[model samples]
Target: MKQAQIICPVCEIKISTLELPQGKNAHCPRCDTQLYRGSHKPLRDNLFLALTGLLFLIPCLFFPFVTIRLFNINFSANLVSGSYALMKESSVILGFIVLFCSVLTPLIVFGTVITAHWGLTRQHFTIFKYSLLIFQRLKHWMMLDVFLLGIAIAFFKLSEYATITPKMGLACIFLTQIVTIFLLSRLSVSRYWQRWQSSEQFQFDDVQTHCHHCHLSQPESQSCVRCGFIIHKRKPNSIQKTWAFLITAAILILPANLLYISIFYSNGKRYEDTIFSGVISFVKSGMPEIAFIIFVASIAVPIAKIIGLIYILIGIQFKHVTDYTRRMKIYLFVKWIGKWSILDLYVIAITIALVDRDQILDFLPGPAAIAFAGVVILTMLAAESLDPRLIWDDSASNTPQKESLHEK
Candidate 1:
């Protein structure tokens, strides 16, 4: 039996599906797309990395990531201990943020990967689906970038008190990031979906039997193959989530811009700058490139991303599918650029790491830095969790000629 043509999600082009023989790969007929071709990571390589990560996970959480040595009196704190100190001091918000970014996210990512591998070996699909969601969520909270910021700030602040340095736990934390990315890249999503499709127990009529929108024929539901519509899962939550996050971010941005993000000291004099003040300082210093980067990263890009996401989401929410192609373009742009908004976090980190001059100059990150980082990361994840196909659902109603005209 010939494998029927199916819509390609990325390209939105109908292509013939080629079924491979057992233990082989398939390709798309129209695009010549290699459906299951990914660089084969050796089994030994994966096992070695996973094992190394497991070994490091132990020390990464326990040993001190930062060591402060002041006048021969040394203090050490790791992920959990730091969080505890923050909690004891009643800095609950920072404590929770640090705990989630440094400890919980890594643990979840590593644990889910291990679980997924073990489940795959046992051929358990239920475990696979649960583990997949766990891994996806981890992508948001796994703030290697944010932790780096904290480390930089800690180093700068401790200059007067001590010579701060990273320790074994810090090294292990860094390694975990590499390990997580490596492991995830090894498992291709398209390939996994293809395998699920080929599995004998995975019958189409079993789960995806009915049309999602019309509850009619599986293929001929509310969706027209010629135009994509939600034959299932009508309200995709993209608009709702985008609007919610954008509004939340907008509110936070005000406080983040107004409150002091960091305090620097020079010759016993204090210098404090809010988010906006820092951007202005960069511009006044005759560093347009730096100024532009800080401006775009700290302010423009984030707001733009949020606003753009809202536009796309609203367009979908109201079933205003006329701009299907344009909406898709905007969606793609938002997806790609939102992550770079983390550049503000990078600035905070770099400043923390470098600015210290024996009380002549010192740097300390503030509440606003944390809040801004949260906004950037939260919005980014919200963007990721949103399904882009939701935008195309309404496209199914339009004829090909109409779609072509709209595209033009």
Candidate 2:
């Protein structure tokens, strides 16, 4: 049996699915977007990883994740401490964001993965189908990888003044991230959907229409039969929606940089630092690597993303086909790097958790913390809203007469 043909969501190229060798990938011929990967590990392995990750989650949530020693005073913090600290400082919204990203999101991902795998293996088709749907929606919100990077940056910043040590819970969180990633790689939703169709002997007419969200073939349907997402040839008002988000993010970037990101008080002295000043502090402190990471994630990437989106939007508006491929690559790069912009926000959360103490020393979330977070989130939305397909549309229409004649 052959796989169904579908259109690439990113590039809008019609592609005929092929039987790929194990561990191989199918790429869109026109835009070079990866369409799908062949199955590698069995379902059972993914199940084991999911279950193991769940086991790791308990320790990560309960025990202290890191210990910091400053001025002969010791402070220990767990996964939940970051949220609590933020709330204690009256930043309730930021606290909730941290709690969702660090705790609730990971828990849901592991639970959904387990449910999907177990239900499928036990032939509980309904449970498997629903579980897979929820999993797909929730996966994008999982930010354990970004949270870990934030922890690294916080450690570098704090190590200059305090002695910091990783605890068992921190180790568990690290291990859980690895296991979750492995499970996700093996649990291919498309493969499972195909298997379910075969098992139920379900059949639909051969059609070229594809679900924008699930990227699955469907026959003249309003919603995807597999994932229930609305079927659309292209995202509605993609360019306009992207421009709105970009403009909002561009405006926020000014406040996000100019206002204070964090305030530190030690021995009756207060010090405030903005995003740029924070990066400069790291440089003056002689930790160039950490400074570079902060600079790129906080300062450079956001500016670059705004410019890239503007360039792509302009190219689309003018029907310019020159360097279309490079523009597509830029779109991909912007999307991939947007998540890392949250690194500084997470660093502040972790620092507050570990550094809060009376009179001797304490750190507080400053005005820019909220503004900076807004910039990160808005830019991410903009990247998601911008349709990469628009980058190739002009080139696709302007194909030389020789190529059109050959095809005909």
Winning candidate number (TM-score): 2
Q: How many angstroms is residue 45 displaced in model 1 relative to the true structure, after the best TM-score fit?
A: 5.3
TM-score of each: 0.68, 0.89
* Candidate 1 residue pairs that clash: 152-352, 212-231, 212-232, 213-231, 227-396, 229-393
lDDT string for model 2 (186-212, tens) is: 677776776556412436545546665
| Count of clashes, each model | 6, 0
For candidate 1, the per-residue lDDT at 372 reads: 82
lDDT of each: 0.59, 0.79
Off by over 4 Å in 1: 1-4, 10-13, 19-37, 40-48, 80-82, 149-164, 189-232, 235-237, 263-271, 279-296, 314-330, 336-374, 394-408
Evaluated at residue 334, the lDDT of candidate 2 is 91
Clashing pairs in 2: none
Candidate 1 global lDDT? 0.59
